[model samples]
Target: MKRGVSAVFLDRDGTINVDYGYVYEKEKLQFIDGAVQGLKLLQAAGYKLIIVTNQSGIARGFFSIEQMEEFHKNMLDKLAEEGVVISRIYYCPHLNGCECRKPQLKLFYQAQKEFDLDFAKSYVIGDKLRDLALCEKEPVKGYLINAEKKIIAKDKNIIICNNLLSAAKDIVGFKNHESY
Candidate 1:
């Protein structure tokens, strides 16, 4: 068996970038508040940063896969310039009915298979409930970014944070609290 590594499965749209709906243009790529600093903290904490996102714009005909890839490349390059390196990115381009969408374990399992992730110690940070669905099925911790203050976590293990930086701080033992 392969040795397991702890990873942080991040959601891209609203969690990292400004979700302006079906964002496929590289020029539209804008990181949310404190996203770069939060990612840097996670990286410094020795957690492999991986992006797990659901991009249904392809299926909806709003954007092509090539366009999305270009956007991702630009985002990666920007993050790299900020000293935040993403270990991998797994995206489900299918619509809601697909098995690889967020809340489904297919892409998550694929990421685990590729990296031999230690789910027990891993974490998920996203702006939506579906982004933290793995917490319902696995032992990993979940941080629901309540930047919009619209979500209320029902699960005990699912924490509520104002942004990615707060979640990263809590994960790195910089703070001890139920919510931030």
Candidate 2:
């Protein structure tokens, strides 16, 4: 089977770390259970791991962009220590209605151009429906974490999982099937 420019776009906050409002301090960052392992698995499976997050805290005056960068630097350093290297990190700092926010495909579009991604072969793993909804154009695959039940999108490409690791498995498995 053949895959396109496959990349795993991850949402931060609840999806990667425990959702604590405007988390800026490095000590405050906590990886959800199995997140590091899951990311390693995806990396081994040849998936480019990219982070697409919405951080309205910048607009809300909770944290500055500099603080966000510091947080991300700490995050990457920690992940690196655990043998996980994120290909890229993209964030939207605007408040609600921002074109780059979740439910909007702006960030995805940017990633597509920057990473040369094929939407059909890409997956967005997030904890919210809006993340899945944003990829409407190409009906990109999606994995929703911590969802009570499977998400029933008008398009059937989205899959819900218990956590980030499970979602990574689902994506890798789906690609494997396509290859076979």
Please, what are the lDDT tens digits per residue for candidate 2 over residues 41-97? 888888889998888899999999999999999999999999899988999999887
lDDT of 1 at 130: 91
**Which residue segments of model 1 deviate by more than 4 Å?**
1-3, 147-150, 175-180
* Runs in model 2 lying further than 4 Å from the true structure: 1-4, 149-154, 174-180
Candidate 2: which pairs clash?
1-179
Shift of residue 64 alpha carbon in model 2, Å: 0.7
Give the candidate number with the greatest TM-score: 1
**Residue 97 in candidate 1 has what lDDT?**
82
Q: Give the TM-score of candidate 2.
A: 0.89
Each model's C-alpha lDDT? Answer: 0.90, 0.83
TM-score of each: 0.93, 0.89
lDDT for 23 (candidate 1): 87
Error of 2 at 108 (Å): 0.7
lDDT of 1 by residue, 51-113 (tens): 999999999999999999999999999999999999888999999887899889898989998
lDDT of the structure predicted as candidate 2: 0.83
